[model samples]
Target: MQLSIYSDKNYLPKGMEPVPMLYPFWTEFIPSEKYPWSRLYGKYLEISNSLFKMTSLQEADLVVMPINWRVIRGESWRSKINKEVESLSIEFAEKVANSGKELIIFFAGDCCVEEIPVKNATVFRMAVYRSKRKQNDIIMPSFTEDFVKEYLGGQMSLRHKSEKPVVGFCGLAVKDSWEKKLKTVLFHGAMLTKSLELGVSPYKGQILRSQALEVLAESPSLVNTNFIIKDKTVFLNTQDVEQRQKARAEYVKNIVESDYILSCRGSANYSIRLYEILSCGRIPIFIDTDCVLPDESIIDWKKYCVWIDEKEIPHIAEKVAEFHDNISDQEFLDLQHECRKLWKSRLSAEGFYTNFHHHFSRK
Candidate 1:
């Protein structure tokens, strides 16, 4: 599929570099020459370059306007960018429609929805943090990466499981706030938190996560660590850089060794750990908190991992044990291999856009 990119490169703010949406923070640490950060930003810019053929708008199948607007709360550079992008998006949409080509408004922001003027257009966002149903067409929540290189490197030895089943989790266990409780009551639903003036509520995951941690803490087969958070502030044992690195190393090791790792929602309705678990070729005990996965219409998430609802928090141990006991040794190993294959083929950025391009081409 031929995709044309339209952008006001000269008008971009100072210190801003032209890169794809949801660019990883660790890109600075890893030299671009040695290891490229996915296919969109760095040296291995194969996926975007191959799939999206940058050409004149008059002769393109699809037109993409990359918007760097971030919908954050305070009066900052984000707010300034949001305003600039909003106007630019409107202008771009009009031009694309006039040219008789489908427009893709690619937003590198956390906004739930940004309404464009053109009818023949699709909006893509990084974080769909809104509770209400979106008005835009084909909006997707792009996933972020933390340690893709390390996770992929440790995939070979990740198939070996311990003698006994172990469920592991290493992240913040936040508590629900009173405001969130009030909003839940007023809205008559926990998932929709727009009434509370919040993009995404931390309470949705916190409630289930805290309950699961409580139940799993007593279980003999669980290897977990509760990084407690009081009022959104995480309380860790040590703040030293070396200690933090050691802790992260230990966390990854646990995820790689354990039979299943707890994949629960955090600030957003989705968890980055879900992808990391798949990258490591390990099963994820997905705690569904009214979450939406990318390409849900095509991907059968249940077939890949054990899906558990928030209401089933009490019976988590039982559910995991039942799943473990039923599967044969060979089946377990196969599932591990399948997890890695799924990540590389569907979940990763390259795989995602490749599949997305194919899906778009069909339409």
Candidate 2:
């Protein structure tokens, strides 16, 4: 069942040039690509046609707005997003409303839970709070490269359960300065307040990350910790080429060395590390804080990773050990391969699109 998609560039917000209508068609290739620090993902470019095809609006099963709403909101630094949406998006929705065509929209960013105000539409976004997510709001995985295949020549080594589970993390956790610490505190406070209203846990990303590391570090009997904790954020689009390469190398090494990677939300309610760990064929000790993961209806995410709730942060080490102890050596080896296969078939950009059309055709 191929989903026929129609898109109009006229609906694109001001100053935005039209790109490919479907996200997987354009997002897989960006200038200065850095997910796996390589551009080998171009190979999957051919897979997009298998599930969806472009068509006329009159014949389309889904109508796309062709504008990345996150980009529009980010560019208008001073303009209110609500005003922009009202002026730019309402017309598009109104045009499609009478046509009786279901809309398809794309949003990418951390904490992009803003309402789209379009009825009968399916929205795909990077971050979506499970409590706030509408029925049509689908959470998508962060775009990533197959790290094991890209770097390790497609070879995956299994980490059998020893006496202790080895948990690893290599990214920003400790706040670098007084200002950053204060900002994190304020952010956590806001989340706490929001949690009360939404009836969810109030665990913010950085704090939860720090606490998880501390818990693992203290419990030497339960887990062996291998962490390269950074005070300042790096490995992003940076000016220092050498520093970027070094950070990227360290990040990959950390994941490869450990049996379980500590995957937590960063600035968003979702973690890109979760996808990366899966791509590397390793287990993720995911800290769940009201996150809506992609393909939840079909994929049993907990089967591939060690899932820990926010309230269970203190017992994180024990949980990791228990999960490790429960699985036999053969099962552990098989899980590593299974994790990689899951990412290749369901999480990667090619995998997502190949299987995603079924999600809409059923509707």
Sequence-dependent TM-score of model 1: 0.75
lDDT of 1 by residue, 122-205 (tens): 666534534443644453534434244554463255455445567777666655578768755643442233222424443566
Off by over 4 Å in 2: 13-41, 75-86, 175-203
lDDT leader: 2
Q: What is the C-alpha RMSD of each candidate to the true structure, in Å?
A: 5.7, 4.1
| TM-scores for candidates 1 onward, in order | 0.75, 0.86
lDDT of 1: 0.59
Per-residue lDDT of model 2, residues 53-128, tens digit only: 7888789888787776766554212223545645676688778888889887777765466565567777888878
- Measured by TM-score, how close is model 2 to the native structure? 0.86
Top candidate (TM-score): 2
The true-versus-predicted C-alpha distance at residue 268 of model 2, in Å, is: 1.3
